[model samples]
Target: MSSRSTYHHGDLRQAVLSAALDVIATEGPSALSLRDLARRAGVSHAAPAHHFKDRAGLLTAVATEGFDLLAAALAQAKDLKDAGVRYVRFATEHPAHFQVMFQPDLHRPDDPELLAAKERAGAGLRAGIAGVPADGRGPDARLAGVAAWSLAHGFATLLLSHNLAGPIGEQDPEEVFRTLAGLLFTSDTAQPPQE
Candidate 1:
């Protein structure tokens, strides 16, 4: 009969989170307010607080969800290059989650669930790097992993901000990333500079 009555009979927590995602996607995370989310979800203002406690709590949940999703996407990759492509795709698809995820100040950094999700994402990236064939020099896997992540994350950020639209006109982002990954991960390029 009424908005409040309808929300009360439905999934208020998910409704609030969905509304919050919409706000973050449209206006950025700084614009997210529990009151606004509650209004959007047609629930009592206090209903969101019952699930999230505060803005930081809600953002922590969003970050956790983002990391979990990223981990799942990475886990499905056939190889290191594919993992980089998947990372870019995940960022583009989940801009709201991506925005809140890396900004530690926007969410509760010490949250256990958030930490676990972050670890899972990190492990997936590391596993992808480990799958790469060694080139006799035995380059540090940790540095290689960081390189892969930086390439994907930087490319995704640039694409999301529309900075690559000119140079990459009409070219598919995933194909570009695959080529970039192939070049960087090759034996010659991956080696340390000779002294």
Candidate 2:
């Protein structure tokens, strides 16, 4: 059977999503269009429109799926450091999804499915943060969670953008991320800088 016929058999929505991801990976999100996705999926131009309604709808679906995937990855992490490494791996492996997941302006932020998936991802990250001990145990824990997330997210973004390629050289990104995560989350006996 032809590709279009295959889409008719089943999984058209997933096919369209996969096509959109390929397009985004190759040409970036700005280049994404429902019509183009339909063409890539070998479906009638109206087929994708029926499922997604518009570009924003398609992006919302992508964002939701992205967050779900991120939550699963984060959930597998044994601790904050492992979570950091997993976050980087997820971003690198799913660059298109990772890009859409962060740029809220591109999708319907109020979509129920999107919000739920976002919450799951947040909870997973928070769980990782909870593994770390803090003195205050209330406000300090919250602050530590935010800092841990920021560090991981920033590191992943920079690594994917090639900002770390020069300084990192051939060293493993996982090891590097683990080291950074440890320094930030774990206690160290280093002396403080003073004037």
Candidate 3:
């Protein structure tokens, strides 16, 4: 279904974003347009322009929504054995947003909403890292974030790129993710408290 919008509608922004997502899902990033989104939303073409100056603004909104959702999902799995697995789940479940988020050239990260969303996503990831045992001020700390982000990002990227579908072998994605997370979560040395 297309989106619906009304200035007074509580969910107008969400409706617009959702409709944009559907459009992106079927048409891919290149086809996104504020006018098209407005059409889908059954709102005036100029209406979206107000919320999103152009395509970048629209994409920024999508990315912000995605980051916010990702942060929430990762936070929910806080007590789970591995937050990285939650990260993978977040990426898989929100492929469209995840797709828009990383492709900076496709969306303007400087957009206020986009920046806030990016910070939230980064904070969520750092929180996940913080839950894990690690310490240091330089290379080691950087490694923790990179390792966790890379592992999750790599898994999500590979899955989306369809490069790991068969090589992953006889296991469901979640099972595989959990198993991988366990291995990755294991530090080379004993767990160290965050500094």
TM-score versus the correct structure, for each prediction:
0.91, 0.90, 0.81
User: Alpha-carbon error at 16 in model 1, in Å?
Assistant: 1.1
Measured with C-alpha atoms, the lDDT of residue 142 in candidate 2 is 72
Better of 1 and 3 by TM-score: 1
Tens digit of lDDT per residue, candidate 2, span 27-91?
A: 88899988888887877777897888999999999999999999999999998888888999999
lDDT per residue, candidate 3, 74-184, as tens digits? 767663335677777887788888889888898887878778877877877777666655444235655778877888889888887788879886667777877777776
Tens digit of per-residue lDDT, candidate 1, span 143-170: 7888899999999999988999998999
Worst 10 contiguous positions by lDDT, candidate 2: 184-193
Question: What lDDT score is found at residue 177 in candidate 1?
Answer: 91
Better of 2 and 3 by lDDT: 2
lDDT of each: 0.89, 0.87, 0.75
Pairs with backbone N, CA or C atoms under 3 Å apart (clashes), candidate 1: none
Question: Which portions of model 2 miss their true places by more than 4 Å?
Answer: 1-9, 137-139, 187-195
| Poorly placed runs, candidate 3 (over 4 Å) | 1-11, 79-81, 134-139, 187-195
- Candidate with top lDDT is 1
| Candidate 3 TM-score to native | 0.81
